[model samples]
Target: MASNPPAPEAPFVPSQRSTEPFGSGSYRTDEGPWEEWNPTEESLRPVRGRHRVAKQRGGLARSSTVLGVGVIAAVSAGGMASANTGKPPVSISMPDLPSVGSLLSDDSADAAEAPTAPLSGIGVTSADTAQGTTDAGEALRTRIMAQAEQQQDQVDTKAAAASAAAAQKAVADAAAKAEKEAEAKAAAAKKKADEAAAQKAEAARLAELAKQYTLPTSSYTITSTFGQAGSMWSSGYHTGLDFAAPTGTLIKAIHSGTVTEAGWAGSYGYRTILTLDDGTELWFCHQSSISVSVGQKVATGDVIGRVGATGNVTGPHLHLEVHPGGSADGIDPMAWLQGKGLTP
Candidate 1:
């Protein structure tokens, strides 16, 4: 659809045979043609309407204009193909046409004087025509590359967020685990400290109670224990602890108490009953003599009586009984003495 300017024509040269004067009615040509020259208005009239020329195909005309146009078309097509396929443009070579500039007639020379039109459409600038790159195609490629870059950036941002969240979660989990371990250690230490404190308090309480109590007698040996199964007394079992000793062995008040009974009768001879402040009673039975009288308050370790074999006795010993709250049934005297921090 596009073309180049036509080439200039060569100068005209008349043959030697056609050199006769213009007044003659005949003319001579190298081809032996004779023609009469007449100047008339009808013969010189300009042609009207469009004149169609036959199209040349299969081969190019031996004209420099045609060759230039073919070369331009081939180069344009190659550039377009290279741009589309992202490949280099192929080189195009024009065939040599000998004496092509001299072959043009006067009509071609006139056409060569006309202005040449652009190969592309209107509004195409000289800068746009370089490298055969169209405005529309370049714009499309630019937009596509920009979109691809944007999508890649979005993917990278999401990946970074996920990684940060995972790291934060790991830190939180570790902190929680450490806190739990610390709490457990603190609790264990507190429990151990409480147990040690309890043992120290118990020891201090026993030492204070030892100051408030004393043993009933010294230089004595245990002959019978409470709860022994034997036919030794009126009761079916022994209800008192027997301390065997030499006669006249002094017995002392077991604790700070008032003497509730002395000079007892019947099975208990010379028996002395000492009542403690808490209404618990200590009975010293089978004594050799009674030194405490009823209603007399005595301190701990004060002499109360002596050991002897009296009524319902088997040998020279003192029978001791303990009655909590003055109850008729008595508990084991050895256990009560140990409760007061006394081993015997």
Candidate 2:
């Protein structure tokens, strides 16, 4: 009751805020209840050349540019390093024009300079960089060592080849020399053999000549005497005497006389003649072989001929004929042999 509480004051009118979107990126606030809250020209208008980019995006772009610059610097450094360290130089030329020349910048001016910073954070100076020159010297030494090794290999191979060739040539020469020596030895042997053959042939010819003329080589008992009226010869005479002996018997000469005849005769085959110093002649007929030659002097007991039945005889006998002073007519051979004390 407090009088109906001031009769419900006129439905309490509260002040209303201006209707606007919550953020700038919104629907059309000017045509809606948010028109009064719309931004004015000063608020909506951007600075003439301002792009209104995000702070982080601008920073990212700057960082990307920096990284690109670093990459370019690294590439240039690598190129300069290659040029100084025995690599082929980079050449650039213009298209459709003469070849261009090169320009030396700071990098080319300090061509022999070494890097001051090490990978492990060591540093050096321009003139003091010579202290780091040990690596370059080592590289140079390695290249020289490789070249020397290659040269040595080539030399060794050539020397080995030459040695092998010399050995082969020596072998060939030795073989040829041995062959020549063998041939010479063979030829000498053949010559010696031929000379031996000639000597034997000469000896044989002399032996044959001795056989042609022979004298009685032995004394024997004369059973049927020669040149007498006896049993064998058809001319009513015996031309030779018979002596008994075994085969392979030894015989000797009658007297020391020169042989005048030997070998076969017409009536008395295998006959021999001996001429004495007094020109007296003695004949021995029917012999195997004569051991004396023509004009050969003989002594008693010398082997003049072997007894054999080669003449006209009925048995193995010695056919003898004697002549005084080489006369054609023969004398009694028995008397002649008896005079010489040869019983035949």
Candidate 3:
């Protein structure tokens, strides 16, 4: 190859003076005898001194490119950083720079002209871009707040529903309890009404029976009740009701009956037994005299005997006993008379 046109002359650059002392064999001026120099860690170590860097043709453009790249990186990561850290967003500052096309081209004239734009206008553009980032962050925060509010509303709605359900359940339970209570009260009232009606009917029946029955003796005072315990009675208990009256007080038939017996008895003295149509025997014992003979058919209230103390030797009275179907065992005469609607 032809010798490269003669290596171009290097451009002149002024050198800065150092304040450090020179080595023993070193020269301070350019015209001195030169010595070889070697750099070492000790020599290269930084010292406390004012230092200055000389500006080069494209230095400002390179610095602007580096700062712009850093600003973009911070902007891109801003949202995520704020979200992750849960901290306030920090402001990013962007310095003025040459235009994008000027930075990419090697044309010195374009680079020089790019920075000539008004700084205020460039500042406004940078401010707008920063504001956009700030707005984006604000929007994210608002969306998060809105989501939180929505979640809270959901919780409140569910709670309200549960409360309403509980209230309704309580109301239903109360209604059921009240219904049961009402039923119980109604049943009790109905039972009471039925019992009262039954009692009324019983009273009317007894009234009708009284017409077909009569007392065994009139104007007689009751002296003893049936089933009275006493040593004087042969069976250790008095088996009949005693009606006391003057001697010869006429005893009447208790109902329409036929005389089954009329004669003297051992301890009973004179006795008369009337057998009713239903086969119930009424005994009029301790009588002074019996007016009816055996087999005599008698109507209700007909005279059958007279009060007496014929044998047992007590005051004058009619001892009355009742036997169902003429059975040997006698029942309470007082109760039997009551059943026939005869008080005496």
Q: What lDDT is obtained when candidate 3 is compared to the true structure?
A: 0.74
Instruction: Give the residue spans of candidate 1 off by over 4 A.
Output: 1-192
- Lowest summed-lDDT stretch of 10 residues in model 2? 96-105
> Candidates' lDDT values, in order?
0.74, 0.59, 0.74
Residue-wise lDDT of candidate 3 within 221-271, one digit each (tens)? Answer: 988888889998889998989988999888988899889899988988999
Clashes of each: 0, 6, 0
By the lDDT metric, which is better: model 1 or model 2? 1
What's the CA RMSD for each of the models?
18.9, 22.6, 15.6
TM-scores for all candidates: the values are 0.46, 0.34, 0.55
Answer with 1 or 2, whichever has the higher TM-score.
Answer: 1
Candidate 3 residue 17 C-alpha distance from true site, Å:
47
lDDT for 155 in candidate 1 is 91
lDDT of 2 at 157: 100
